[model samples]
Target: MHSAIAPIPIDLIPSWLDVLAVWATVGAALVAAVTGVLIWLQILQTKRSVDATEQTLTLAREEQEQNRELIANARKSRIDAELPKILVWIHTQTRKAHDLGVRSASGAPRPLTELPAGKIWSLPDDGASELFISLTVAVSNDGPRRARVTLATSNNSFLLSENEQVISVGEETLIEVRRKYTIEDWAAMSSEVGTRSIQDVLTLTYVHQGTEGAIERWVVRQSGSPLVPVPGRQNCWQLGPFAARRGPLTSLTAEVEMPHRDYYSSMSDLTVLV
Candidate 1:
């Protein structure tokens, strides 16, 4: 029926101030929700930035390592290019020139006569009385190219006399160096040549190919000590472990060139008067 409805209850109807308060509360909640979402987004951006920085550092380290390796390889290559290719080794001289032979009764070279006491080989009474001593240095060409060797620093060692002035060498070449001796050099040396690993050393200037000036230095070791002079032969000394072991006759006297008698002898064996 169209009867008039009783007026709506006023208490149930909210006042304007209450309605404004409700609106304000809703707005505050929305603001708080938006602020929380923004905070979450910022956290994600920060994490991404940290990961990017770490990646960059990793790349830099890898690049640095690669550069170091490249630099080391470059340096090694440079050295290989600049340095000359030469190798050297030394040992006793055992080889002899068979052509210059003076066979004795036993078909072997005779032993050098021990000089008489107080008699010098230098001021020999006869030309035949004069003697020769040598160092017998060995040389080899241990390079890819041909080389020529010239004596550079020979100290004129009384024991190591210099005779050969210059020598030539080819690739993979080897040679026994021979030298002559003079008694004038005897003054610098002791009567007894001492025992040592190497008797002495000689320095050589190696010229590569046609180059006149020296390009590199070459060092050679002297043969074993106590060179026993070959007899009947002017004054050639025998060098080698075996020759040195069978050295110095007890019956022979010491000479001016070689002052050591290594072994003792009797008075009757003394031939020439001093």
Candidate 2:
């Protein structure tokens, strides 16, 4: 009877800590997921920013290259614009040289002056009996710092002029002087001349020089004679007083050594005196 009565009520204790631990575990899982998502988003944003910056830099570099090209082209245009004016000045000077030659030849007290006015000679369109003259007269700048000319000949050797006087960077000038050609008498020789015919190897030598210097001898030859000759000397027989075996012939060959240059202009209607 006593044992049965003792089966009294036994109380069970509740664990509050266990419930709190379960809630904490769920919260931690939520926090971890949010953190991982935020990291991924940050990486994507950083990549986008870098790509944008690079594209902007590339475009800016291209713009700079274009600007440099434009500047270079502008400079070239300016130089071209100035060239014509310079040429006009040179012609003015050439006129002055011609006037001087005439004054000196007239036996008048040479005008104590250098002025633009003179006769410039060119060959006749039909040709000459004794001279080969220039039809294509070229004036040119031999170097950026120098100028020169070439008298384009018909039957004579090339005529080139050296840069005699200094033509400054921006300065334009003309060179003028009289060139004289004298032919020695060829008729006085006896018919008993040497074995070679007088019609062979006859020629002369002339000179070219700077504005103020001694002239240098250049060779000349006639058109009808043998085109080739001894190198150093001008053969007078090349000048011709020839009796053609078959056909009638007129002009002879002549040449003048001229300088070579870069850019040039031409003047026409030059008159040549026999």
Candidate 3:
């Protein structure tokens, strides 16, 4: 009865399998931690890439707009410079045709570029209708002489409007001219005046002389009808009356009277005639 049980065999204990289980658990935890870190790094990189791309696009658009504006301004300058030269040439040709007694059905549109710098023009809406031209003249004279300018316009296509006290010859000396016209009805006015319409008038007082001299005012408009000389208020600028028509082709000649230059202009002084 006192017989002792045989001691369990140490070699039969499960040591290797338990050790393998512990090693596997530690390896799996290490792998999971590494995977989480890699995922966070990837998300941060993706956000930075997106932000950089947006910034690049914004800069490109701004550059494009600036280029477009520069191109527009250059084109406008070319147009302004060439317009006056062409107007003057057209006027000369029109006069030649008239003296030779050549009749035209629809008179040619005078080249706007040939217009003198001292003159200003009001053109109609170029896209929809024919062009309309107007002129302003400034003359400085001492004794008394005559000068002539020819104006060619499409019959019934041109208008004479007023620019008030705009031409300045010198200090305390200015020329003011007003356009005389009757609006048949203000209610009948168009809301939009195009290049074909007399939409606006520009007034400028160009300095033609200094403070001292005898300067006489002259009329600046074209008329087919003979000019009737009338007494005027002292030193007041005079303009011929205009008869407007709706349709017809006609050319006008202006006979200007200017006195001989008694006041010599010095090179140091600035003279802006155009």
- Residue 21 error for model 1, in Å? 71
lDDT per residue for candidate 1 within 147-262, as digits (tens), equals 44555434333222243333333444333333333332222122344443233345555433221111455555443332334445553433222222113322111111211111
Clashing pairs in 1: 110-231, 111-231, 112-231, 250-264
Residue 107's lDDT within candidate 2 is 68
Q: Point out where model 3 deviates above 4 Å.
A: 1-16, 83-274
Off by over 4 Å in 1: 1-79, 82-84, 91-130, 133-149, 153-170, 182-201, 207-215, 221-274
Reference-based lDDT, each prediction: 0.41, 0.32, 0.32
Candidate 2, lDDT over the whole model: 0.32
lDDT of 1: 0.41
Q: What is the lDDT, from 0 to 100, of the residue 76 in candidate 2?
A: 36
What would you estimate as the lDDT of candidate 3?
Answer: 0.32
Give the best candidate by TM-score.
1
Q: For residue 170, what is the lDDT in candidate 2?
A: 56
Q: Compared with the true structure, what per-residue lDDT tens digits does model 3 show for residues 52-82?
A: 8877777777787777667655544443332
